[model samples]
Target chain A: MNWNQIRTVYGKEMRDALRDRRTLLSMLLVPALVIPGIMFAFTAVSLKVVKKAAEETPAVMIIGPGNSEPLQKALAGSPKLRLVPAASDYAQQISDKRIRAAVEIPPGFEADLAANSIATVKIYTYEGEMKSSFAAGEIDRILREFREAAVTRKLGERGLNASFVRPFEIKRQNVAPPEKVGGNLFGGFVPYLLIILSVVGAMYPAIDLTAGEKERGTMETILCSPVGRVELVLGKFLTVLTISLSTVVTSITSMALSAVGLVHLFAGKVGAGAKAVNAATGQQLPMVDPVGVLGVMVMVLPLAVVFSALLFSVSLFAKSHKEAQTYASPILFLTILPAMAAMLPGVELNAKLALIPVLNVSLIGKEMVSGSFRYDMMALIFGSSCLYGAAALAVAVRLFNRESVLFRT
Target chain B: MIEAEGLTKVFRDKKRVEVRAVDGVSFRVEPGQIYGLLGANGAGKTTTLRLLATLLKPTSGAATVAGFDVVRQAHEVRKQVGFLAASTALYGRLTARETITYFGRLNGLGDPEIAVRTRRLTEELDMGEFIDRRTDKFSTGMKQKVSIARTLIHDPAVMIFDEPTLGLDVLAARTIVRFIRDCRERGKTVIYSTHVMSEVEKLCDVIGIVHGGRIRAEGTLDALRARFGQRDMEEIFVAAVGGESALARQDVPPATTR
Candidate 1:
């Protein structure tokens, strides 16, 4: 192979691709601006919606207001729930979302408690509606407090303390560090985006360099040169790899900056409300580890090569740019499915899974981001990815060498 | 020098039908001589030139260019030959100088050599006005000039042009015809293929009348006219390929179009 010729081809292709607006959009603009823009928009909207749902005071109707005057007074006195007048069509009102929930205090409910008898209070709500659900939860909390006070009064009558009913306490805590917590939370997501971005980044240039040349009638001119087919393929492959890696880096940088900016904005604006929002959603703002992120980027290298080679090989079968896109669509979907499979809950990477192409990279990337390094698995994944990349490159070279494929009508 | 001993190329279509694109073609052209292979659209003229240029390997038979076997030493053959087809195009995004320099480098020329060749080709082809401009916006004539410069950048010993003036305007076509003549003046072995009888009469030192993937007649314009008992070159071509009826049977219009 002629290294000089390869460099010549690579340099020319890179310059050509840079001048192309389509390649620039996919490799730089989309990953750097569009992705982070969508992420920021989605996060801001969801947080705002959650916070609104938590803060809204919803109206509730008492079905038997006269039978439990004290209970009605207590419900009306609470700040979270607004007691509405007695109504027979409480279910209809809840369904219409006019009233958040309805509390049915049974007849003689206080007399049953006074006689130490069991009575059930049914709270009706609009299922699956966020505001209604919040209202129902507040009503339930107040009812539970009233019942506990009654129990305490009963204990006082028996000359006993409230501690007699409770034997021990249970507490829960997380042992993992914040970085691991963040990694575990965003691990599946980050790798999935990076893998997809890498593939997307390589797509246009691969199609443009191979099939685009054929359509433009430049393939014959280049074929007549002294450079070998293998060298030419290598040159083109390296160009695609460079664009693919650049896309991933741009996306990572954009996402990191967006994450930091959003974190700071949330801290400054909502302060404790952000924590309340996180607690309500069972998610915390993740603290990304710079070193761990670097590790993930390192692991993505071989996989990027694999995507570049595979895309090039597939696009070479097409005779035009449009046809090349058709040929490459299936490959994009195939990679996506495996990357998504790695994101499923309980889908941990095993020895066998480490040999799979996109899935292995995604799974291992998650671990790397979480500050965990299973070197054996990492080596296995890296080696297997390299093998796949080499094989795909061989296929590209072989296809490029075939006159029938190159000059197909 | 260039030589072909029964060079042939076969292809199979999508329906599994076999096609002899080039069949048992034999010819020779010495340095400084212009050999024109004249044929209609699908008479395997392009295939023959492609085989000689090492763009496509011959299915049967053998050929040599510049003392190297086309099949066994394709890389060497490519290094020694400059090929330009009418369909061949330039990289639209590259400047004319860059395009020429790129091919020079691909041919293993050093930086100093490429720079010198780029300047000379630019001057020779009258491309100085657009040498530093991207080729996408150039006129057909200007682009053709750049393509010629790129083809000759390596200073190869043999030049193969396959219908290089197919779709050019009169001025552009004249430039290409002049370039072919210039190549021969420089002692380059030139094989020019076309279906135009006037080009053959005016340019080729030796002419090969090709029909159905085989050369039916081979000689100078005068020799062919004498041997076929025809005064006009087109009549000589028509008679050499078989007769008027054979041309009719092949579904080809008379060679008067281009």
Candidate 2:
């Protein structure tokens, strides 16, 4: 009951936990490195695939050979493209994945060009194939270029300069706050993913430290000492909370750095966002700030602390590592339903949402990533998280005090 | 003095069928005496011990530890009663001194008082060598000594050791036996439970033999022996249970009780 007792228990436990390497790795090392690494890798791989596929022109068979030469020339220069002779049964080949697409150019050939007519070319592709849409888009782009070339040629034939063939070019740009920019690039994912990571990061340690002590038959000794249940719970809860929040903060830093390709390790998970026009040498766009990065981290840390305490409470009931995990897995399922609420885009984080603990925090986290900030909402998250943390810790202490739970075997 | 008057404890389960763990147990031990409650597993020795320790509330009847009601004055009882159970292990992460100091504080001793008590208990229990060492490094006998130190830390007037030598090797057991005797010499009231007849004969000044949720016999070892008209205490124990052989069967761990 005394502060000294709480301090003693807390000090000893923290020292022991800090010395334990597995606790450190689970709570800090893994989250600080692995999560960001996985996210960056995912982002990088996806970005590469998208960019590569966007530039490629998969083989297209011009069925009618109506306007084949210029389209073939445009596709030939692209390495991602190939030109194949039309099969007698191109239909079967398309279904069998032999060719990416078959283009049906109307049979008019040169007549359509001389008539200044609106020509139509049909591009055939199987639905939902990798790079298939790219091939179709390339065909469309080719058709547009061909129309411009034909008009210019016709004007030249009449001795005009054909200046009207392409009078202007279209340019697109983005103006968003760095965090929002970060979010836009990898925004929705950061909040929810970090929340999960923070909670998950604390899971093993909380269980190992609190419940593990009981299973090992050491808690009674510890508790029978001058330490009261409240002090013991507080000390352990704070350790778990510290470790969990540290992981979140580290993830936030890693995600931010990786968002700009400053760290290649997690480039795939949170790749570079839209490049800004430098206007100096017309090089690649500048790596701007990511979208809604702050909000995601702010919201996820509380959730992480709540889950850490909760998992610790349950884990303490388990008698062994295997037994702890058995209960922990079900608890993991408990988290999933609440966490899934965050993935719902456009769901409002109302006052009701903040009262529900995990799901509410998740909703707040998602809202944060969307660059939405409410001071009251923030206070609710912090308050409720701490309250849940205290409650879960009380449950853990109750389990500690119960001889039946500790000696379940 | 300590007293349990017709104290009974019935552990209720989800099923309505009731199985009494302890029933109609009554006894008294004066200060400066070691009272042994001898019973095999499920004989309610532990339940009686728990009720006396204020850890479990008795279902019926009443008991008091050091003039404080076990249930209503649990905090007061805890303040005066020092409990050492086989189930309680020392904090491996803490030094023996730290462990004893902790319990002393819990018993409401001020900082200086706890420090004085910690030093005296550790020294008296022969824990001086490893009192500063973390419990994780202590040998089995050493841990038991530290556990004894923790129990005595508060300088409680009443001390209860429940199967305290359990899982302990002979050397550790001997140290505990000596410690119990030492408590008696110091004029402390002791409630020590064990089915170990040798321990009872050698250590208990007054003994209570329990069976089937009640005390079957209570007296001096010689008196108990004479009651059954047996020369050997083991025979007296066997004869006390008559033909049931319940005492012999209960030595098997509770897990084997099919």
On TM-score, the candidate that comes out on top is 1
- Tell me the tens digit of each residue's lDDT in model 1 across A1-409: 7888899999999999999888889888987889778988988898889778777789999999887877888888899988889788889999998899999999999999999899999999888899998999989988998888888999999999898886576666667777788777878877888888889889989999989988898888899989899999999999999999998898888888887888787765556775775786565656556776787788889888988999998888888999999999998999899989988878999999999899998998888788888999999998998898889889999999888888776
lDDT of 1 at A279: 82
Number of backbone clashes in candidate 2: 28
Tens digits of per-residue lDDT for model 2, A68-120: 56565765565655778866777778787677787787777567767877677
**Poorest 10 consecutive residues by lDDT, candidate 2 chain B:** B249-258
Candidate 2 lDDT, B58-157, residue by residue in tens? 7899998889898787667777877887877766767787767666765667789888877777667777788778888888998888888778877789
- Per-residue lDDT for B1-258 in model 1, tens only? 999999988877667677787889999999999999998777789889988888788999999999999999999999999999887899999999889888989988898998988888888888888899999999999999999998898888999999999889999999999999999999999999998999999999999999878899999988988898898988888888888788667743221111
At residue B244, candidate 1 shows an lDDT of: 72
Q: TM-score for model 1?
A: 0.95
Runs in model 1 lying further than 4 Å from the true structure:
A114-117, A277-285, B248-258
DockQ, cand. 2: 0.37
RMSD for each model, in Å, please? 2.8, 5.0
Give me the iRMSD of candidate 1, please.
4.0
